[model samples]
Target chain A: MRVLIPIDGSECSKAAVDYIKERPWNKDDSFLLVHVVEPIPVDIGIAYIPAAYTPDEGAAFTQSEALLQVVLGDLKSVLTNQIDTKVIAGPAKAEIVDLAQEWKADLIVMGSHGRKGFNRLLLGSVTEDVMKSAPCSVTIVKSAHCSKSE
Target chain B: MLLNLLSAPKTNLRSLTNMKILISLDSSSSSQRAIDFALSRPWAEDDEFLIVSVVDVDRGDMSMASAMTSPNKTFNSEAERIVSEAKELLHNYLPQHKLETRCLSGPIKQAIIECAKNWSADLILLGSQGRQGLNRLVLGSIAEEVLRDAPCSVQIVRRKFSRREDQS
Candidate 1:
């Protein structure tokens, strides 16, 4: 089976990776690791700059690159041999579905936040969207051992 | 010949017990686990099994509403296709044993609870994605809800980790 795992570099996402690492997957099965980078609002960077210290486009680009490196590095360290990884720029939910379709993935493995009540309404969950939209099956991995602090 | 062996006067068919298992599937890996769990059991030939997939009514209605507003009317076709596909997926997995399926439309938790009640299932099995924080705050956990409200027992099967360090 071909599996697509969408990661956001959050602890919850890492928990998903951890869950997969512990599972007994078939030797022939392929795993794809996908990270979607939400488009950074250019206005935010422009808004924060002072008249005397204008934010350079080069600097912003460099900063984004550095952040991506850290996230990708952490992902690489956790992934096992033979797993394919890709970093794309788009909405997390939509990109995940797009990648799944592109890969013809048989399954999508992800982690859920386990939110409730008003908190859930205030912040819509991407896992929910992916679960509803994905062409194939999905698995949500919640961290059983980790508490709110860990 | 096998039937004759089983028909020996000493054998009691009444003594043979069949286990009842319930599988909740939604085109996910956890559904696969549910299937594997059911198949792995040392079930007698007469054992009964049920496979259920809950279609969220709110989601269906919301999509339908959105489609009505769309100018092209293309969303209607898309929605129909999706439902048809879901049904096909459900049918593909059914074989042997006593298999039944439902395409319920409503809140996932509510539909599941209703089904559990109507079926009087012995065990409700699910896969957990383990979403929490903001995501959980929004999407709600069907497994968690089922665990809390189901009339019968609930079993959550998580994905097996591939790494030794990650294992618990």
Candidate 2:
């Protein structure tokens, strides 16, 4: 089976990695670990603070790339040999679905905050969007256990 | 509303040997994938499988209401049609496994959650459309809501299939 796991550098996302590690997967199964970097809102950058320290368009692009590399490095450390990693830039839910379709992954395993009521309504979960739109099977690992430590 | 029921303390695991599993059905490839995944697992011998198809009354009013309320020979005929199709599909895939089928009326997500709680299902499995972009943002996904509030563990299946690439 081909599985796609999306990580956001959150411990909840890492829980998915741990779940797979504990499972008894066949040698034939392959995994793709994906991380999506949402495009930085240009307005936020322009609106904030010191004009001297503010980066130009080219400099901002470079900074985003650097940030992506750092996040990918963290992902690489936890991912086992069984998993392959891909880092892309876009909205988390859309990019994840696109990658799943491109790879023809049989399953998508990711983490959920398990938000409820007003919080869920306001936050609008990415896990929810992925569940609605994924072309393959999806497994959502709720991070209730992670919240306890916080 | 169903969240209250789900939040109730979990039943003893030791007494759950014969638990039921509700597999939500649609014509999507992802739904079929979920069925395949469930069958692949080693479930207890006494466990039951209930395949359910919910008719979303809110989506279409007259047609759905007529199908459910008509007492004549044509009563719930559309629902029956869907139930039959689901049964055929399930039987074709799981011929040996004993299965039960039901067609209920309500919102899809709410109906599925209620059925899971009513049946005390140990797990709920669903196949997602995997719709993305602006379309998905406007219309929320059922699989996501079920995952968050389901009384039991929920599995969302997407249709992506990957083959192992040999490293050697």
Candidate 3:
């Protein structure tokens, strides 16, 4: 199966990786790990005083690339089947759905309710958006924290 | 408001020897893919399979009262056809399993959940999405809702694809 997983560097999203790795899926199944980097927030400069050095667009790209690299490193330990990584810049929900549709992925497995469950007044913002809009079947694996709290 | 076409006996004889697997079925291609995936798994001697189809009255009705009325004759026949077709399709998967079929009415998600709970299903299997063309504004996700609240674990499957489209 072609599995598409979108990660955000959150432990919850990473737990999605852990869940897939632990499952002894057939070796023929391949995975596409996609990470979307939202553009630098417009208010970053105004929201906080320049107590620390500010990052330019190049700095931000480099940072996001490094984060993807770290995620790739972690996944390397678990995924023996064919796997690929992609880092793009766009809104999380739309980009993830577009990638899955364009890729014609058969399955989308991801962590559920990672960031917004506690603070955003609603649960599963990005994951829910993808689940509702994606072109393929989706599996929302509960994060370690989300499961524990439940 | 949910309706059951088949209210299983309180004591299901098959549950003792098999895992009661509730599989939601429809005429859609995605639903076929879900059945294909489930049957591919190596089966134990007794693994119960209940194929289900839910008619979403709420989606088409303007009011809950209109939707909650008794199942119309047209719907009753349609549900019967769907149940029989699903049973026939599952017959090829494992002939020894003695598969069951059911039809549910009401909002799609809640009806499926209620059926699963009533059957004491060990697992709920369904297509990730159903009959798309009604934009997100019209309908949210049935699979996502079931995943969050079902009494048991859920598996969402689709037509298997490869990493690259050309390879498939």
- Predicted structure with the largest DockQ when compared to the true one: 2
Candidate 2 per-residue C-alpha lDDT over A1-150 given as tens digits, one digit per residue, 9 for 90 to 100 = 677877654545654554455444555567777766565446556453333223333443344345435434544465444557666666777998899899987778876643233354322378777777777777765433433432
lDDT of each: 0.53, 0.60, 0.65
Give the total clashing residue pairs for model 3. 0
Writing each residue's lDDT as its tens digit, candidate 2 over B1-168 gives 211322334223323345566888754565666665664544555667888876654443345455556533243455566557766766665676667888876777788999988987766777654222125453336776677677665677554332222222
Worst 10 residues of 1 chain B by lDDT: B1-10
- In terms of docking quality, model 2 is incorrect
On DockQ, who's better, 1 or 2?
2
lDDT of 1 by residue, B40-81 (tens): 323445545666565543343344555556623443344344
Model 3 chain B lDDT-worst window of ten: B1-10
lDDT of 2 at A69: 51
Better of 2 and 3 by DockQ: 2
Compose the digit string of candidate 1's lDDT tens values, residues A93-124. 88999998898776787756422222432223
Give the least accurate 10-residue stretch of model 1 chain A, judged by summed lDDT: A114-123
Please tell me which predicted candidate would have the highest lDDT against the true structure.
Answer: 3
